[model samples]
Target: MKIIPAQEFEMKRESDYGTPEQNAAVKEIIQAVRREGDAALLRYTEQHDKIKLIAGSLRVQESELQAAYDQVEPSFVNAIRAAAERIRSYHQRQKRNSWMDLQPDGSILGQIIRPLQRVGVYVPGGKAAYPSSVLMNVIPAQVAGVPEIVMVTPPATGGTEGINPYILVAAAEAGVTEMYRVGGAQAIAALAYGTDSIAPVDKICGPGNIYVALAKREVYGAVNIDSIAGPSEIVVLADDTAEPSYVAADLLSQAEHDEMASAVLVTPSRQLAEAVAVEVERQLELLPRRDIARASIDSYGAAVVTASLDEAISIVNRLAPEHLEIMTQDPMEIMGSIENAGAIFLGPYSSEPVGDYFAGPNHIIPTNGTARFSSPVDLDDFIKKSSMIYYSKEALLRDGETIMELARREGFEGHARAIAIRLEQEQASQTGGNDHEL
Candidate 1:
């Protein structure tokens, strides 16, 4: 890992997001799936994932979901159950009811919140099993009262025959029975535009590899999409009082996610920065995914020494990291000044992994600098709202002239005339068909 001064620090976008050529290839895949449907989906699945599948095998069978429980240990089941309840409890609070406000003129205006009839969740597979991904994506949709929650994950991870049992068990625990064995951009295509086996969904959400992320971007308008996620990133803002070992471990947690994943430490104390630099080196030697973490740390990781803790926090906002940890004399004091971050872990004990797994909040967070404008996946992602309006005759009559005047000013004569005609008719009725001024 490099220890660059804060004055010389530069943030670089990771290249793993894919080049133009990769994006073109993904576009071709989405178009092919749209044109060829199941045939193209099967072909791409075989070509990319090295898994040959017939149309009948595209969807996971009910029997397979039942059998997945037998393959996993009891401890795993209990853990998922606990995570599910906590996640559900957290999201249920976000559930909103239809509301209305009655006006003085007997007019009523309201918002009708309706859960999407169907939704698709994409869980990344290939590198490792993300059973937590299943819970994070599906539970919110379920809480939104969505009737059909379809999940898509890559099949044959590392050339294995079946999907990961942990993922299946998590899905089962979350009550997600409708799942697909297909993954990659092709799976996104199937979700965006229906195939013979899989029906199209109203919206798609989840994190995936670059191909999947680009595919989601391609199919966004065809079906609603969550934000285009980039590689994982974490920025730790610590002071001299922070423990170097805990800071080192937190930085490495995001780095191990992928070679493109970035882990940065920002501190005011040169002593703490030097200490964390050493600890990160020591910890990396023991990490199981040392190769990947090393690549990330070599290119993207940094230990920036700012002039002050306030300066470190300012730099963190500029970066708008996906995960931010504030380990200082008072983490809350630093937290109050933070303007941008997807998730914030305060103090020493609140590690990044806590929110990733057991903690109630969704781990599907905004990545890259998207935290500057976007948000983590939550209950709102799964629902749509229809504005409700009830206008009494008196209400429209009182506001009719104002509406016409504004419409006329906007050069919408047709709109103005529409209101004028109604007003004229009302006047004619009131005056025994003699309201000529109207």
Candidate 2:
């Protein structure tokens, strides 16, 4: 890790729009699926995932879902079940009810909050299994009262004949109503456009490779997508009182995620900054994903030294990291000044992984510098709000002229006429006079 002054350190935000070839490939795949439906989906799966399947076999069987239990340990099942309950409970608090406000004029105005009828979650599969990802994406939709939650993963994961057992169990525990064995951009198209085997979804959520991200970007208008997620990031804002070892470990947690992932430390104490730089190098050698971590640390990791704790926080806001850990004498007090961060961890024990796996908060957070403008995945991501207005005759009549003035000012004669016609009829019914003249 390079130790540099705050003025010299610059946080890089890498865009994952993908190469032109990759974009063209994704576009071709999406168009093929749109034109050929299930045939294109099956062909792409065989070509990219090295698995062949018929339309009848696209959807995972109910027996396969139940039998997945026998393939995993009881301990694993218990943990996932516990995690699901916590995730569901946390999101349930965010659930909103449709509301209306009545006025003295007999007018009603409010918002109608309703969950999406159907949602598709794309879970990445192949050499790795992320039961945690399944739980993170599915439970929020379920909490928002989404009736049908569909999950799609590659047919074979970890060299197994079918999807990873852990992922299957997680999906089952999260109350997914449907599961499919399709993957890649093809799966995204099937979810967006629908096929003979998979019904279309109103929205799609989850993480995948460059192809998946591009596919989500391509099909956004047809269906809602969560976000084009970038690499993981963690920024530790520590003081002299912070433990170097703990700081180093927290930084490495994100570094091991991807070669492009960034792990940064912003602090005022020069001694602590040097200590953490050494500790990160020491711990990097021990990680199973050390090669990936090393590349990340070498390329993007940094220790920014500042003149004071306040300056350290200023740097953090500019970075707007995905995850932030405050390990100072007063972490809570410092958090009050933080304007940008997807998730904030206070004190030493509240590690990043605690929120990533067990702690109730969703781990699907805004990455890069996007935390400055966006938010983590929540119940709002699964539900939509429709504005409701019930204008009584009195209410419309009282404001009709004002409405017409504004509409006509905008050069919308049709809009003005729509309000004018109603106003004329209502005023004539009340008084035997033309409302337009009045």
Candidate 3:
């Protein structure tokens, strides 16, 4: 690790969009699924995942879901159930209702909030199985009252029953009614376009590799997507009062996610900066994924020294990190000044992984400075809102001219006429004659 001034520290973030070759491959895969349906889905699954499957056995049967529980340890099942409950309890507060505001003019102007009819959650099972992802993505949709929540993941191996037992157990605990043994760009296409076995979904959520990201981008307009999530990111903003060991461990937590992940520390105290840099080296040796973490620390990690605490905040806002940890004398006092961060950890005890696994909040946050504009996945991601407008006869007649004036100013003659025709009919009925005669 190296210590540099705040002015010299820059985040090395790669584009979420994959290479040209990858993009072309994704486009070809999506089109094949659209044209051939189940045939293309199975062929691609066999080619990419090395899993031969018949169309009849594509969906995960209920007996298999029940058998998954026998494979997973009792302790693992207990923890997943507890986490699911917390996640469900937390998101329950975010649930919204359909409401209408009755007006004095006898008009109802409000919004109708309804959950999407069907949603697809893509869980990555390439390098590892993310049972936590099943909880994070499925629980919120359940709280939002989504009726049909479908989940898809690649088989852990070549066999039809090669899906990871832990992931299966997690999805079952999270209340997923439908699941499929498929993965990669083919799975994304199946969710978006629909196959003979898999029904099309209204929206897709969760994280995946470069191919999966590109596939989601290609099929975006056909179905709604959560985001083109980037690699993991973490920034620890601390002062002299913060613990160096705690800071280094939290930074490494994110760095271990992948070689492209970024972990940075911004502080005003030079002594703390130097201490953390040394602590990071000592801790990296102990991590199981030290090779990945070392590459991440060597390529993208930094310890930025600033002139003042206020200046450190300015640097953080510019970066707009995905996970920000504030370890200071008074963390709460500093939190109000933070303008941009996907998730904020207030003290040393509140580590980034706390939110990633056990904490109630969703771990699916925006990345690569997208926190400046977006937010973490929540109940709103699973629901769609429709605006309700019931214009009263009195209100429409009163505001019809104003509406027409604005519409015509924008060169919309048809829009103006729509309002004009309604107004003319109402006026003629009221006066018992046409407007010209009146």
lDDT of 1 by residue, 1-438 (tens): 788899999877663557999899999999999899999988998898888888788888888877888888999999999988888998898888999999999999999999999999897786688898889989999999999999888887524757887888898889887999989999999999998999999999888888998899889898999888788899999998999999999999999998889999999899988999999999999999999999999988999999988789889999999999999999988889999999999999999999998889888888778889988888889989999999999999999989999998999998988888888888889878855453
Clash-forming residue pairs, model 3: none
Segments in model 3 whose C-alpha atoms lie over 4 Å from true places = 157-161, 434-438
TM-score of candidate 3 on Cα atoms, chains taken together: 0.96
- Local lDDT at 265 for model 1: 94
Better of 1 and 3 by lDDT: 3
Tens-place lDDT per residue, model 2, 1-438, is 999998898887678799999999999999999999989988998898888887688888889878888889999999998888888889889889999999999999999999999999999974357899999999998888899999999888746468888888899888886999999999999999999989999999999888999999999999999999998999999999999999999999999888989999999999999999999989998999999999999998999999999999999998899999999999999999999999999999999999999989999999979999999999999999999999998889899999999999999999999998998887787788755642
- Give the alpha carbon lDDT tens digit for every residue of 1-438 in model 3: 889998887778977677789999999999999999989988988899877888787899899888888888999999998888888888999988899999999999999998999999999976567899999999999999899999999876324458888998999899898999888999999999999999999999999999999999999999999999999999999999999999999999999999999999999999999999999999999999999999999999999999999999999999999999999999999999999999999998999988988889999999999999999999999999999999999899889999999999999988998999888888788889766321
Give the Cα lDDT of each candidate. 0.89, 0.92, 0.91
TM for every model, in the order presented, reads: 0.97, 0.97, 0.96
Superposition error at 347 for model 3 (Å): 0.8
Model 2 worst lDDT window (10 residues): 429-438
Candidate 1 C-alpha RMSD relative to the actual structure: 1.5
Candidate 1 residue runs with Cα over 4 Å from true position: 15-17, 434-438
Record all residue pairs in model 2 with backbone atoms less than 3 Å apart, i.e. clashing. Answer: none
